[model samples]
Target: MSQLVSLNLPAGTTVPSHADVVIVGGGIMGTSIAFHLAEAGVRNIVLVERAELGTGSSAKPLGGVRATFSDPANIILGQRSLRSFEDFNYRFKTDIGLRKVGYLFLCRSEAEMLDCERSTHIQNGLGSNSRMIAPTEAVEINPFLRKEALVGASFSPDDGFAEPEKVVQAYAEAAVALGVRILEHTEVMDVASADGCIRSVTTNRGTIQTNAVICCAGAWSQRIGEMVDVHLPVTPVRRQIGMTPQLSTPMPTVPFTLDLSTTMYFHNYANGMLLGISNSNQEPGFSRDFSHEWLPEFNAAARICAPALVEPELAQGWAGLYENTPDHNALIGASKTVEGFYYATGFSGHGFLQGPAVGELIRDLYLSRESFLDHSSFSADRFTEATKLFREVHII
Candidate 1:
């Protein structure tokens, strides 16, 4: 399989002189948040990015957009985002190519199957259409299958994947049309503040004189937080994504399949298929280079789940970084250290699917509107003192 290459943006322009709100990073999270803010009538918003928009982790492939998560927060977040994706074509006047290919979590043990069944019940309760299918029934969903390795799985028909760049562009273009200024290839070098509130944001291009700043810098959020004396536990972890060659044999109508035993997932990638495997010893850094050693492990894991992957002459791969938090959840909402400083980062690997919902939440919080979802659970304050632990067993 081919390897994933790093694509960084050119050196950004100098920071702007002034703006009402300054947002750092122009990935899916930043653009979505900017779009929602513009929709909420925050006209004078400035989004600063070190490189071209969505070139970071957002540009990576295997865009599986699913709402059938084991965690309630993830389920709700994905559901809201799915609505936005369904309406994206009309909203942006551009086809983002969101295909409802479905999601299936392959179970390995009775305990895993029970957890999936329980999660499916919760999903149904929350108005999400997800069902637990037997191993035999799963083959109907995807005709080609080695039934021995598979037990049962949770299937969500409405879930799917989309073009990441198109979605990011749609949000950016829409936000711009609404009077939001996005400064691409512009880096925020220093975050200036005073008296527990933001004073200004200094970028490579120029200094944005804004009391309000949203640090959507993804993996680099920890450094930004340090500028304000706040210790955010967000870190960057590398994740590899791969696509297998289009087989001559008719491919089954496969849902996004995950092997519970190996934490590896493979799903339909456009016309072909895409897969990803977790590394227990992934180096922690900002590097986006693909590793050759990881592919064999991923291939073995994929074959164990779907024996079809063992066929030679079919595989391509790429790697990207995931901003992970202590609990493998995102850190959203206002900062307890600084008053006007807000943050939305550390989404782990689920950033793309959760983008729109997070955008709406940030918009509501910024505009002082009543939000339908309770975001207090996602606040950065949870890192300090006692708090509730959000467990999401279904992660790949």
Candidate 2:
């Protein structure tokens, strides 16, 4: 976790008086949106970041990129983003250190195993290489797992991880080259509108008049949406991850692996391992400090799943936020209440992996073009709809 290689682009001093489009948030989400819009010939694009680019959750992620999901929307988003990451080097002229070690989810019970198989069917139908596997096969793939503990698993060789910071840097750099003005250290104070449409954005630096504005504000999107009278139920829940020192006894490189029951996941990192577990008791807020407060819970779950993990002390670690929605899915659509206001937030923990394709999706939505996937199910308005909330079947 050394300092990230600087994006090294010239800085802009003044916020523009007007822009063709104003993008809030400067993480991979906003930067990717900017890149896509600029690539589509959208001019006067302005991206605003309160701090430097790639702050908050985008700054720290295990970077596990995967398309293995029970939900069609998530599966499609992941599949498309995997293709973008694969072609990123040719398009952006930078190596993102992508490791296609694949992803494997270990299931403990008949219920969990049944769910994995069911999800695998959906994944395979969407042209993914994922398939359900026996406990023995799952152990063969990762070798670190206890075969007796795992009843079943699902794996896809095409899904893997990459450096998230690099992706953000690439998109920001490319967007800047495409004439997108990125205003770092500038914070948005208010969003002004008239006649149910966006009129301008007021920031700490200055106000910029723009007809269109998209909220890519990640975990803080709830606040941003409120400014425009839009309800974007994005809550900031901190997720922590830690890396182990290089193992004394070299372990076989394995795919990104997760225990479905406990949500304890681990993957190879710096010749050691990156480990994380969801704190079920975690409150929704913006606390990004890594702590041992959840160690007891993680240790209890680790014993049940991976006995080899002897509560290894993870002294070096960082915490990041997950822009969680009520049903743990994404909110990607325009606002009916506020015209010229759009959003793409609340991916739960899937934002980083889905950023690339989502950029294109948001760009198309902005331009009123047809998107590859039907985004109706993902609209923010569904929260108030009479029907039941759309939920993702498999999550980690």
Candidate 1 ranges beyond 4 A from true positions: 1-14, 247-250, 311-315, 387-396
How well does candidate 1 score on lDDT at residue 160?
A: 84
The reply for model 2, stretches above 4 Å from the true place, is 1-13, 387-396
Can you give the lDDT of residue 62 in candidate 2?
54
Q: What is the lDDT of residue 354 in candidate 2?
A: 94
> CA shift at 73, candidate 1, in angstroms?
2.0
- Locate the minimum summed-lDDT window of 10 residues in model 1: 1-10
Candidate 2 residue-wise lDDT at 252 = 85
Query: Which lDDT tens digits does candidate 2 get at residues 152-265?
Result: 889999988999889998998889888888887788999998999899999887789999999999999999999988989898998888877777787788999988888988
Each candidate: how many clashes?
9, 0
Q: Score every model by TM-score.
A: 0.91, 0.94
lDDT of 1 by residue, 1-396 (tens): 111122222345444577888888888999999999998788789888787888887887647798887778888999999998999988889787788988878897899999999999989999998998888888778654567778788889999888888888888888888888877667777888888789898776667788899989899899988888766688888888777687777666687777777887777765677767786768788888876656677767757666666543447778788899998988888877787899999989888998999999999998888997888888878877443333333331
